[model samples]
Target: MATIKDIAKQAGVSISTVSYALNGSPKVTPETTERILAIAKELNYIPNAAARSLKTRETKIIGIFLTDFSGAFYGDLLQGTKETLTRKGYELIVCSGKQSHWMLPERMIDGAIILDVTFDSEDLIRYADRGHKLVVLDRELAHPNINQVLLDNKAGATLATEYLIEEGHREIYAVTGPGSSYDSKQRLQAVMQVVERTAGVQLHVIEGDFNKEGGELAAKAIMAGRRDGQAAAAVFCFNDEMAIGMMNYIAEHHSDIQVGEHIHIIGFDNMELASYSQPRLSTIDYSKRKWGALAAEQLVKLINSDAVENERIYVTLLKGKSVGTSK
Candidate 1:
């Protein structure tokens, strides 16, 4: 309700003098600034955020975009991003859905870290063309304004598949994530490559959406293919969420088909729940927190017009009771 005009009129000063005093400009005397501040407090004056942003040309805020908030996957990642950004004098805002995409183009955030598969590569390129700095976690895009901090999906998948093969699994089931997913495609390609090279090995590909329901459905298919209490078969679920889903389904419905016994299983992501399962889930391990932290760091560098190199989070294979040697 209070404007600079009102403060100037009450203080018996010009509007420009009021503006300078309110902004803490050294041009205005300390006495004038203190008087103007007291009047602003009495009037409950609030500075305009839009005007401040325009003058500074920076908001000191970074946005992290995710495809959707689900499972235990995003917690550590977001924590890493927030801690890194906060330490660097910036704030982090988590966003999702189509509406949040506008935040980048509209210049509401200083920079962005993207892991949302729903975001098109062309759109990201367009944003780069407009000089918006970005760091991508789920896909590859080469541009000076854009950097990548992606997982080593191919190596993780290879480790998962090779571990099963070393355990003498010939008939392996490979549950895949969404077709459009870059990680899925990379992981599946690696799995197929290993399978082709291993003589007498067969890989049955099952389509999945990287969700629990997809894992449950894949479980049903696997169960149908083999009889109860027969020779054990190995299954490689694309992600830990799906692997846990399959384990749950088998435990509830098929008592005879034990996870580590009749149906050996392996998964990727090494999620927290993997260790707590009845037979600890064998999985591909990587540092999700570091993945997020690096992305934030890269985005900040890009925003500052500093040189930034693309980054990759490495992976390892963690053996567990969920995987057993085939008879």
Candidate 2:
């Protein structure tokens, strides 16, 4: 509740003198600085950050925007981002929804890292035009103030599909994320490309929302379409969350179905639970921490007016019991 005026009055110094001493300016004597600090401590004075930022033009904080905070995917990514930002002498704040849009344009934070699809590319470009530094994880934009740190979605999807084809599976099912997701579109494009070039491969696309419920529905649809004694088919869910949902649905309701044998399953993201599943999930593996850390690093450099190129986090295929040779 205490202010600089109270500290200055108690220390028997002018307000400007208190400001210089508190800011460690050489214009103020060490003796006066010590007196001002003692009085500030006694008064429990908390300096006004907003007022200081107005003068300095830097808040030393960064905002990370997400669509929502529902899934387990954000934990490690956030840790990476937070740790890197802390090491760079900045604070991290997680934000979601339309309300947080004001933080970037209003200069409440030094910069922003964006992964939320709800933000329109034009809006982001407008912000970049206004000199707001940004690092985008979800989509690409060409602007001097904006940098991209995107996943290698196309390559990862290609790897997943090729793995299934190598196992001698001809009928492939691809479950996708929301229509709005750039990652989903990229992965699906790659899947179609692989199917188109590979002779005798039939690709079935299932629309998914990148959630467990969506996965379960996709599984239901896939199973419903199968004949009484059809051969085993391969499925590639765009993310582990949906893949886990599909697995759970099959386990609980379809007693006759088995994962690795009857239905070869693969997913992307290699989420933590993917390894712990009954038949460990075959997935496209990439470092979520590294993705987050790199985004933060680039955003910091962008903020400091350093030259930085766009970045891509690569992926690899992790084989597991969830996938098997075609029957």
Candidate 3:
């Protein structure tokens, strides 16, 4: 509600004098600066950030775009991004949906870290052409203004499949994520590759939506295909949520079916709930916090005009009781 003119009128000084004092200009005496600051505090004056940004062309704020805030998977990732940005004198804001996409093109944020599947690569390239800096976690885009921090999905998938193979599961069920998912596609490719090379291995692919419901549906289908109390089979759910869903479904409805005995299972992502299950879920493990931190670090470096190389987060096989030697 208060303006520089009001402060100038109250202080009996010119508008230019008020401006200089408010901005801590050396042209104004320290006594005048202190007096103006005191009046500003009393009047609850807030600086016009929009006008300031126009002059400096920097907001010192970064945005993280997500598809949606769901599940237990995003906690450490977000924490890593926030902590890294905060330590570097930048603030982070999480955004979702198509409406928030304008923040990047409009220069509301200095840079962005993208993990949203809805964001198109063509649109991102257009933004990069306009000199916007970005770090992508979901897909690859080759641009000087854009850098990638992707997971080694191929390696993780291979590890998951190889673990099932090592457990002597010849008839393996592979539950996959959405068709549009880059990670899902990459993992599926790896699974197929491993299945092709391993002797006498067969992979039955089940389409999944990267959710618990998908896993439940896949479990139902698998159960229907097999006879009751038959030999054990190995399943590789593309993500931990689906694996948990399948486990929960079997627990409630098919007590005759035993996990780690009649139906050995493994999943990707190594989500926290993986360990909490009755038979701890074997999964592909990677550092989610490190993934997020690297993305933020790359975005900041890109913003500062520093050369940034695309980075990859490696994966490992985490063995758990949910997987066992098949009969």
Candidate 4:
């Protein structure tokens, strides 16, 4: 029921002054801005997103696009974005691109944080073509207009495998993600690189959906003894979900498989549950939430700013009991 004019009158300021102060225009003095804000708050003023967008060309909303909205894999990542955005006073709008799901046009978003969209180069091209502020995470596509938050997949993958090797594990097995996943290639590449550089060490490889069931099946087949000599001395899973599933299988069926003594397992993504798994899981602890926040932050900067800012973030490893002596 209260209008900007009413607030302006009540604050003893002109309508233009109230408008400039509320919109955060630099022309408004700090003292006047504080007074206007205090009055606005006392009146419980609600900003008109639609009306304000028309004047400033901003909705103050960031779009988060994902392929599928399932599992802790993404949940962990959202954790970072949510916390970071909240602190910065930006709101997030999440949309999934499946089937009839079209991309959220620029009208709904001032900027976007993209993750794991099924469409490849062309979609990214079209996305970039729109000339909207965009930040892509977990995918490798380069463009002058697109800001990417990427990781050293090969390096992180190699670190997990090499850590297992240093722990005296001989035979290592790996479970990869969907073929379309860029991370799948990078992580698997790390495993093979270690295999090629070493002699007499066997690497058992399998592919899965980056889910728990996939890891369980990969574990069963790899441990079934089809490769040279013994079963996998250790398994390095692509994600923590798969690693947890593999551990569950070992607990229910292969009780004799004590981690460290029998077989050690390492996983990537260092999910919240990784440390809680039976013997616990050793994993790469990259901040998915940080990535989310960073992605959102970058997109916002691109949107509000006149220039583009792009950079890559490094992921670190979190040692756990499963890797032996790590906590």
Candidate 5:
């Protein structure tokens, strides 16, 4: 509720003198600076960050935008981003939804790392054209002001599908995330490519929402189709959450169809819960923390006008009891 004007009036000094003293300008004498500080403390004056940023053009704050904050998948990633930003002398703010998009254009944050599909690629490019620095985690944009630090979704999908095929599965199903998701699109493209070229692999595709519920739905569909005498099925759920859901469905309803024996499963994003599932989930593993850290790092470099190339977080196949050879 206090302003520099009030401090200046109380100290019997000009407003400009108060401003200089508060900002530690050498033009103001130490006696005047100390006097102004004492008055400011008495008034409990808090400097306006928005006004300060207007003058300096650097907020020293970075924003990370996500679609939502409900999943375990984002925990390690956000922690990594926060740690890296703090190390770089910047602060991190997590944002979501359309309302928060204004922060980037309004200069509320010095830079942004975008992982939200709700954000239009065109809008991001427009922001880049206007000299806003960005690091994209979910989509591709070819602007000098923007950098890409995306996951190797295609490679992970290929690895998961290939692993299923190697385990001797002929009836393979691929459960995908929302159609709007860039990660889902990339992973599906790779899964389909691998299935198409492989001999005698019957590929079934199911639309999923990258949630546990979506996995449960896919499991229902798989069971409904199994009445046609399909002995064993290998399913590649786009993410571990969905895989866990499907496993839960099978364990609860189809008690006879044991995971790892009758229903081999593989998933992307080796989430923490994947290992603790009834039978450990076989999955494509990548460090979400490292992905987030790289995105934050690249965003800082972009903001500094340093040269940065596009970055990709690689993946590995983690074997688990949930995936076994089809007999």
Candidate 6:
């Protein structure tokens, strides 16, 4: 690896001059700084992490922690966050460390962004416990030290349930995701509220793990043993994956079940693939990317600002075309 010594020799300046110029010190003249930078770039000189860390006490980089990155969820989130932060001269780091209960970067850097933490709040809590300046997206939490940003899970679910109710479908079947997720738990609770207000209406509930396989099995379970008048006309899945799985089963054996004809289907996330599906699954569309950006902005402002306290960020609801009927 090329070193500062190499650049200094090439730029024909003293080592001290090179250091001052490259590190953006005020003592260095603008003309010298430009010349040193040009020489360093020409040589493809990469600064030592430790040396750079000592100088800036900041990497101007954000660490991103998330479970799954395959679907629209993490992709959209990264895009939104990168657009905002990088434009402001910050870089991002993505680490898929789902195996560990918590994460401690091998090297220290500035700040963090956590997404869909999946019940392992311990790592974050511990980080915040140490007064780490960080932001969280999607998990509804707050602390004196850490800033939080999350979706209005109850509101979104309530809106979806209300839409289903208005579709003239009284008997509804609900497929819930694995019981662990904050979003899943809140969403199921919201559906329960709808069931309570509308008397004699039953919403069948099943457990899924927020994946396609879970959805397939849940639907098969429902279809195999559905009692007379108990099987719902439409099933509301916890997310697009489960909905798609349910759709797959419906297509394979129950080919007669047409979306909006025999049974209606709805999903969450409004993932890109959701629209391309056979009937084009209807889902809730919210900006995970915006969610990511908001979370980062709040945390950075809180930590960097001289303000003594941090504030909270709220979420919005998005409506999509999964519901096929009208009241």
Q: Which candidate leads in lDDT?
A: 2
Error of 5 at 83 (Å): 1.0
- Model 4 lDDT tens row, 1-327: 677998899989899999999989999899999999999998888878778777877777777778787678787577778777777777877777654225345355676777755646676667677776677776766776678888668878988888877776667788888888888888898789998897766787888888889878877875676444344377888888888888887777777667654678888887778767767678887767677777767776666654656666677777777444222
lDDT of 3 by residue, 1-327 (tens): 998888888888998898888777999999988998898889988877777678779888999999889877899999999989999989999999999999999999999999999999999999999999999999999999999999999999999998888888899999999998999999999999999999899889999988999999999999989986566889999999999999999998899888988899898999998989888989999989999889999999999999889999999999988444644
Model 1: number of clashes?
A: 0
For all predicted structures, in order, the TM-scores are 0.90, 0.96, 0.93, 0.80, 0.92, 0.86
Higher-scoring candidate on TM-score, 2 or 6: 2
Model 5 per-residue lDDT tens digits across residues 190-288: 988998899888898999999999999999999888864556789999999999999999999998888988889898999999989878889999999
* Regions of candidate 5 where Cα sits further than 4 Å from its true position: 8-39, 322-324
lDDT of 6 at 25: 95
**Top TM-score hit:** 2
Per-residue lDDT for 146-178 in model 1, tens only?
999989999999999998998888899999999
Clashes (N, CA, C under 3 Å) per candidate: 0, 0, 0, 1, 0, 1
The per-model lDDT (C-alpha) reads 0.90, 0.94, 0.91, 0.76, 0.92, 0.73
* Global Cα RMSD, each model: 2.6, 1.5, 2.1, 4.5, 2.2, 3.2
Candidate 1, residue 235: how far the Cα is off, in Å: 0.8
Q: Tens digits of per-residue lDDT for model 2 on 1-327?
A: 998888888888899999999999999989989989998998888888899989989999999999999877999999999999999999999999999999999999999999999899999999999999999999989999999999999999999999999999999999999999999999999999999999999999999999999899999999999887788989999999999999999999898999998898899999999989978899999999999999999999999999999999999999997445554
Estimate candidate 3's alpha-carbon lDDT, on a 0 to 1 scale: 0.91
Alpha-carbon shift of residue 4 in model 2 (angstroms): 1.4
